[model samples]
Target: MRIIVYGTLRRKQGNSHWMTNGQWLGDHLIDGYELFSLGHYPGVVEGTGQVYCEVYRIDASTLGELDALRSKGGEYKRQLLQTPYGSAWLYVYQRSVAGRQRIESGDWLKRDAVSE
Candidate 1:
């Protein structure tokens, strides 16, 4: 299976260590979604814009760990999205993004370059 990560799980980010077991497949833009700043991390929801993400080929164990970390059924939900690498899992935010700062640039790595 594969997963699309846009925030801390990306290369050189804080939580990237968790992706050590996965294969790096490069970054890509996913349409029909939006990225937002959730304090130290980020949350992506189905919307009208696009998000920058890194696609990775992962194993079952890594997927399980990621699910636990994302709070699968609570804060985020795993959804199958069509990527350049074919169908992959994307963690969609479940809670309301009211008042949350949106990362208009859609790229978490370059998030600091743009302001809401």
Candidate 2:
């Protein structure tokens, strides 16, 4: 299974421990979306902007683990979208991003520049 990660789950991001045993495919640019900083992690929405993401090839077991984490909290909802790497799963913020800081660069690492 292909998973597109834009925030903490990315290679060196904070919560990467949840994605063990996955192979790093490569970096990808997911279109029609924007990234926002929600304090600790990032939130992506279906809108405008090029969201930089890392694609990973994860097995069924890993996918289940990811699904549990993504949905365990009400903050996010998992969804699939077509990327250059093929079909991939990504998490979208379920709450409002009104006051959240926007990651204009669309890069999760760069989000620290303006995040709280």
Give per-model TM-scores. 0.94, 0.89
Task: Output the lDDT of residue 111, model 2.
Answer: 70
Collision count for each candidate, in order: 0, 0
Compared with the true structure, model 2 gives a TM-score of: 0.89
* Model 2: per-residue Cα lDDT over 61-103, one tens digit each: 9888877887776878879888777898888888889998889
- Report the number of backbone clashes for model 1: 0
Query: Residue by residue across 7-95, what tens digits does model 1's lDDT show?
Result: 99999999999899999987889999999999999999989999999999999999999999998569999999888888899999999
List pairs with backbone clashes in candidate 2: none
Best-matching candidate per lDDT: 1
Error of 1 at 89 (Å): 0.1
Residue 44 lDDT, candidate 1, scale 0-100 = 99
